[model samples]
Target: MKPAAHVRKTALPGVGTRYDLNTEAGAHLSVVVHQDGRRIISFHDPEDDDACKDAAALAPAEATALSALLTPDPVAHLHQHLEIDLVTEHIPIGRRSPYAGRTLGATQARTRTGASIVAVLRRTDAFPSPTPDFRLALGDTLVVVGTREGADAVAELINGG
Candidate 1:
């Protein structure tokens, strides 16, 4: 069995958390996850611990793509090729939303915005492929699958446009 590499985690006050790891090849690498969901990957110079040889900043979406590439999950590989054009978003129904007490059919999300509500997350329970008659509630998170624009439209519509 291959031994697990030890990763050191450091807290950067007022900045973010950093995870440092030494590769089997003796290279130093670190990844920082910021408060706003941004990520920075850095390769350190062996001679100078504080010096960075190269660095790359990645947005949340870019980081997700990079993570998928490095993951061994079979399901993750299936959607890698379709990452560019397809987008999956989770939209929350707020307390002030007009559809909070209404049925899913009222939104007409798929017809009007072209986004499909594949699931609804209510507390710890998940309702998959919810029917149009499914009632919406505050704090329910809608799992939507569609283009970016379509997801944005769904958010706007659910929040009373």
Candidate 2:
């Protein structure tokens, strides 16, 4: 089981408030709400409670951008999560997506499109190279592998466009 996030908010007397977050993955983030309407961010040691992990003190906008940059987008995370080969597209399974609620075998996905649905991301878990008999679900992110044209064909095949 994964550890839950631990956060603490404290009033820093005349300075302002301090918000500290201990993330599930052992990351530590601290933000100081200064009385001057500025925030001082700090990176604390995930292992050592007293020592800092790295560095940073940024304005709100800078803080946001830093956070955004640190956070990986869905596709980027998928690439990191999977053992990829050839080209791959993270195709979202929407309601109108033809593969939704359908069996992979029924779609003849491999036989027709030449794009292999090597993995499916459903919520938090990833199903890699799922069986042909496995049924696809709505909101699943299908990891397809092939050439650009083949990927496009697979997308078109599923979207019925």
Task: For each of the candidates, give the backbone clash count.
Answer: 0, 0
Query: Where does model 1 exceed 4 Å of error?
Result: 1-84
The lDDT values for all models are: 0.89, 0.78
Write model 2 residue lDDT over 34-99, tens digit each, in one string.
887677877888777668766566775456556657775657657766775567787777788867
Report the lDDT tens digits of candidate 1 across residue range 1-161.
47778999999998899999988898999999998889999999876769999999998756866885776764666786665766788888997689998999999999999999999988768999999999999988899998999999999998888
Model 2: CA > 4 A from native: 1-85
Q: After TM-score superposition, what is the CA distance of residue 142 in candidate 2 from its true location, in Å? A: 0.4
Pick by lDDT: which candidate is best?
1
Model 1 has an lDDT value of 0.89
TM-score of 2: 0.49
TM-score of each: 0.53, 0.49
